[model samples]
Target: MTTLPTLTLRDGLTMPQLGFGVFQVPDDQAQQAVESALEAGYRSIDTAMIYGNEHGVGRALAASGIAREDLFVTTKLWIDDHGRGAARPALEASLERLGLASVDLYLIHWPAPATDVYLQTWQGFEDLRAAGLTRGIGVSNFLPEHLDRVVGLGGAVPAVNQIELHPALQNRETVAANAALGIATEAWSPLAQGAVLGEAPVVEAAAAHGVSAAQVVLRWHLQHGNIVIPKSVTPARIAANLDVLDFTLSEAEMAAIDALDRGQRTGPHPAEFNG
Candidate 1:
């Protein structure tokens, strides 16, 4: 099994650069999928309270017999739970569902600017970390403005910013902002739901490397230094996603994929969404 590379977060924690994501995976099915991923050498698992599959993830973790210290579990607080008193309980509920004492990382799932409470939610995250409920805290789908506000609060800066990033949606501005603020950038929907896999750059690179187009894209993300989580239910696909550690993409190859960005987004826009 290939050991995935690790990222040093600003919070002084090491995170697996490539992890497994359970976004749309149903609650009942998440256990099997996550078990396959762990069996395939995945140590990091990204889930959310809104996903409603934390219990299934907990089952897989327990059944795998992997030591608690060896796993890095990250769950998010949903938009509905973005406030002072709400975040702590939301994470407590998540921990109960995950059957764990504390999560490695907890994130504000979305900024939801209309709600005007993410600032409070972020502050609450700091408190959770102090209480040992989470090892680190971050935000997902947050824009540059949201990040600025979070930083302006004079609290702990976020550890990472997980966003919708793929070949078609590079999110360069936010990525640069994260770097400027010393926050690692994590990418969800890394392959664009297989929407960009068939592109000429991805397909050609796959053929050149004798790997799948998905692997090429994953490699591109890795070279760009983005923490990427690619989700798959199939056992073979789950394993294949982790196989990216064996190969490297050239600067030209990386540039070719970089040219494929078209500002496309598969998820909701961060600014307009309140829930």
Candidate 2:
């Protein structure tokens, strides 16, 4: 098994920098996908209430025989569960499905600013942490404005901020803000849905490093200090994604990939998405 690098959250909790993600994976297939990822040396698992696959994830975790302390499990609170009262039960239900007493990290799936209830949702997260239901709290798809409001609360700060980040959409402003606030930046869809895999920079880096284009992109993310969760159902690809630790990208190569940023986004804009 690979000895993956770990990042410490602001609250002092540590998790593998490169983890497994289960997005768009059917509930029935999540178990096998996650199991394959575990067999490939992944100890962290990221899922969401909206994914509707926590039960399968739980089954795989239980069957893995990997001790709870060795695993980092994260699940999200959906837009529908965006309120003081709604957040706790939402995570409780997720814990139920995941068959765990508590999750390692629980995040608000999106800001859903139009709904105007994330503040309350965040409070609920804090309460859960105090109650020991989750080890840490965070928000996903949150822009600076949303993060500002939560930070302004000055009660409990977020430990991580997961967002749609990749070579095509670097999300520099958000990344900078997260760094300024001492929050870890987590990259979802880190491969740009395979959109930037064939680009010249990625291809050239892959050729130079004797790796695949996907591995080049993932390596770029890791080198940039961003936590990434790449998802793949194919067994070989899952193993390959975790095999990026053996190589390094030169400074020029890193700059070339950085220049590939054109503000392209594969998902809905954070401020515009109400749900």
Candidate 3:
């Protein structure tokens, strides 16, 4: 088994750089999928309330028989629950659903700047951390300005910022901003929802390396120091995704993938997505 590298958070905690995500996975399949991922040596699992499968994730965790301290579980607060008063209860509900006393990390799913309540919600995150409900707290889909507001006014720096990134949508600005603030950049749609698998650059690299296009793309992300969560329910893919730790992409190959970025996005823009 490949030992996945871990990234240290600003708060001194470490998280597995390569993890599994349950984004569009249905409730009926999430448990078996996550159990397979765990069996494949994934220590970190990312889930969200909006994904509507936390319960299944919880069931898998409970049944895995893995020690709680050895796993890193992350769940997010949804857009509908974007206020100071609403955040804690939402987290508590998530805890109950996850069957855990506390989570490894808690993230505000989106900035939802349109609502102008992220700062207040961030304060609630701070309160949760202080009260020991979560080991660490962070944000997702937050732009630099949104992060500035939280760090500047709310006074709590996020440990990580989860975003949609891939070879086609590198999101350099956001990644750089996260680096500047010492926040780890986590890539959610690391393969662009399978949009990048057949691209000429990825295919050529995959053939040259004798690996799958998905492995090449995932290796690109790993070499770039971006935390990636590629989700798949297929047992082979679930195991193969973690196989990226073995290979390395050259600088030229890295640059080729970099050139593939055309500002394309598979999901909503942080500045525009209110929900």
Candidate 4:
């Protein structure tokens, strides 16, 4: 089994650069998929309360027999739970569903600027971190403006900001902002939900490396220093996604894929969401 490379967070915690994501994974299949991923050498698992499969994920983790200390579990608090009052209970519920005493990382799932309470929510996360319920805390789908507000208000800076990033939507501005703030950038749709796998750059790179187009894209993300969580229910794909560390993409090829960014997003915009 290939050992995935690790990225260091601002707070000095190490995260597996490539992890398994359980977004859109059906409730019934989530456990089996996660078990397969763990058996395939995945130590990091990304789930959320909104995904509605944290229980399944918990089952898989318990069944894997891997020590809790060896696993890095990450879960998110949903938009509806984005306030100081709602934050702690939401995290507790997530921990209950995950069947874990504490999560390695906790995140505010979305900023939902219309609600305008991330500061309070962040304070809740800070409280959770201080209480030792979560090893580290962060946010997701937050924009540059959100980051600025958090910093300007003297709130806790997130260790990471998970977002919709792929070859089609690189989010250069967000990347720069996070880099400046020492926040690690996580790529949620690193493979574009498999939408960009057929692009010429990806396909050609795959052929050159004798690997799948999906691997090429994932490798591209790794080279760019984005924490990538590419999801797959198939055993072979799940195993293959973690086999990216042995190969490297050239600068020219990386540049070609970099040019493929069109600034399009498949998910919702953070600004207009109310919850």
Cα lDDT listed for each candidate: 0.94, 0.95, 0.93, 0.92
Tell me how candidate 4 scores on lDDT: 0.92
Can you write out model 3's per-residue Cα lDDT over 195-219, one digit (the tens) per residue? 9999888998898888999999999
**Pairs with steric clashes in candidate 3:** none
CA lDDT of 197 in candidate 2?
96
Candidate 3 local distance difference test against the native = 0.93
**Which rank order by TM-score, best down to worst?**
2, 1, 3, 4
Model 2 has a clash total of: 0
| Every model's TM-score | 0.99, 0.99, 0.98, 0.98
Show pairs that collide, candidate 2. Answer: none
Between candidates 1 and 4, the lDDT winner? 1
Better of 1 and 3 by TM-score: 1
lDDT by residue (tens digit), candidate 4, 1-275? 67678999998889999899999998799999999999999999999999999999999999999999989999999988888889889999999999999999999899988878899999888999999999999999989999999888686789999999999999999999999999999999888777888889888888998989998999999999999999999999999988888889999889989989998888887787765
In lDDT terms, which candidate is top? 2
Q: Judging by lDDT, tell me the better candidate of 1 and 3.
A: 1
**CA displacement after TM-score superposition, residue 75 of candidate 3 (Å):** 0.1
Clashing pairs in 1: none
Q: Which ten residues in a row have the lowest lDDT in candidate 3?
A: 147-156
The per-residue C-alpha lDDT of model 2 at residue 75 equals 96
Clashing pairs in 4: none
